[model samples]
Target: MTTPENSTAPRPIKATGRFMLAHPAHIIAQGFGSGLSPVMPGTFGTLFAWLSYVVMTTRWPEIFTPLNWLVITAAGFVVGVWTCQVTGRHLRAPDHGSMVWDEIIAFWLVLVLVTPATLSSQFAAFLVFRFFDMVKPPPISYFDRHLKGGFGVMWDDIVAAFYTLLALALWRAI
Candidate 1:
């Protein structure tokens, strides 16, 4: 017997590069397309940020100073807003899953706090940063849900980075 005309399921919405690029905000906020991964997009975005950290630290250690961290964080805040606006408009939804630029910036911030000149130390920092980000304790969760727009997206991760920094500092002290 032939299936009914409506029996076939509707095709899934395919995420397209053109769709992402329709807005300029998405381009910068998504860390230059690192946030566009189909699977585990946040993780992939964070990895991209980590790789950037590695390069920055190795090639331009002088530029990785505290002042530079502040600058980067500020830039992330500005860019994050645009990212949220773009992704929200494109998806017609707030804080879409595919928009992981905030995570990338947050991971990068965390890296600055715990960064060691050694490869092992960097790996340790990465693991610790991921843990805090995923766990989202206290204020981090609060900010994540309550805040709106790009600020909301970036703030939670910043809190997570602070938490990771504190934990790592304590661990090192002990």
Candidate 2:
């Protein structure tokens, strides 16, 4: 995967260790290759998270409880922190755009929290999430700028999820 001489797209994180499949960190940090897309990798990664969450819930309906989702989201965050750290070091890019575990796990949280909703509702959630993730509003922007390393990478998306969830809650109340 060679970048063109003048291509602005990010080269997929130094494909040295089994092309991002050999190591667990690389696989996760790359969002199972969803992050490898040259265009809107964050969007692709979040979509992957949405699809994955839907499939999981559909396949195992009993597993969609709030407690289960919280546990799963927490575990993903813990693992994401370590993997993001490793992958960032391996790529030598502190916050590579292609490293999208932040989007994947963060969006997973959104989908899980908003379960049992209509497709339109889900779409609205997705759009709101993408907007906050992309624009990085207020505290989100502050964390994205002020934090460092893997924590910084994941913090902004978590904040985005908060904003998205807040919006969805208000919409639900109306």
Candidate 3:
């Protein structure tokens, strides 16, 4: 597809470490380079989110409380909207697969809500979140198709996170 004459989107370019480092938005929206993975960039972004969550909470328990995590995730989501928008414009692909900040931030939301659990449970959460994200069931698919801009890019994953949490909650209740 060709960008319109009046489009603000830039000419599409390959996502590279050089390009990622060229702008703060690129760095953030690319999941700090995890999005550069040649294979399953979204999965890699989620992995980065899980590992970072573990490291931060474990290494700085005093500062990385659940309350703190709520704040961080909220801030991440807001920042992700802008970063993803800017990066999308630069890439000229509004929802380029390489832009995995949506995955990273969304999985961070999952981790925050399902924490204080065993590694096995966290892995289960990861699997479920990935399933919902990739399958894009119903409204998730709807938003992914109809929403535009950075918010559109990020919203579907938030829905996926909700699905994941709902599944986990049901599992726990059973």
Candidate 4:
């Protein structure tokens, strides 16, 4: 999944200080260290988001409503902008692969959009989101290139999520 947009050249991350238990920003920004994977960290982070979303919705039940998910996603997206900004600055990359708060939260937005989704549909959403995120078509590419800092780091994935939602709606129509 290493595209020019998501270059995989290993950047030397300051592991100890940023990843320490005291660093809440680091923890949230890195998707709890899923981004540290040597391979496909974004994929891992998206999977982590999926599993966490499924678990929370399944276990809590009360907070699984559509309204709640939307509110929660909006809040998380706000936090994610800050997380990506801090981590991107720390890593010195506008959209670093290891700063996977983008992927994790973006996929969560997809999950919320496709709620009550079957396993197949959820899997489809995953593939589509990852594809848009990786390929970054049109405006996605524009945002990725033109935008900077945390919001820029996070915007393309939000665009990808929108694309995924559109795809899902089209799929349902067919």
Residue by residue across 1-174, what tens digits does model 1's lDDT show?
Answer: 446565564433345578667777767665667767877667777888889878886789888876797788778778787777667656655666667778777777777766464667767767777777778888888887898876787778878778877887898899
lDDT of the structure predicted as candidate 4: 0.82
State the lDDT of candidate 2 residue by residue for 36-152, as single tens digits: 887898999889888887788788879766579778888888888888888888787778877889998888788777845678878998999999999988999999999988888
Better of 1 and 2 by lDDT: 2
The number of clashing residue pairs in each candidate reads: 0, 0, 0, 0
Residue pairs in candidate 4 whose N, alpha carbon or C atoms collide under 3 angstroms: none
Candidate 1 global CA lDDT score: 0.74
Clashes of 4: 0
lDDT of 4 by residue, 2-112 (tens): 887798776656544345344677788788888877789889889998998889989987977667887877887889889878776666665778778888888988997
- Residue 168, candidate 3: Cα error in Å is 0.8
lDDT of 2 at 157: 97
Better of 2 and 4 by lDDT: 2
Off by over 4 Å in 1: 1-14, 61-66
**TM-score, one value per model:** 0.81, 0.86, 0.92, 0.87
**What local distance difference test score does each model get?**
0.74, 0.84, 0.91, 0.82
Candidate 1: Cα lDDT at 58: 78
Query: Clashing pairs in model 2?
Result: none
lDDT for 15 (candidate 3): 89
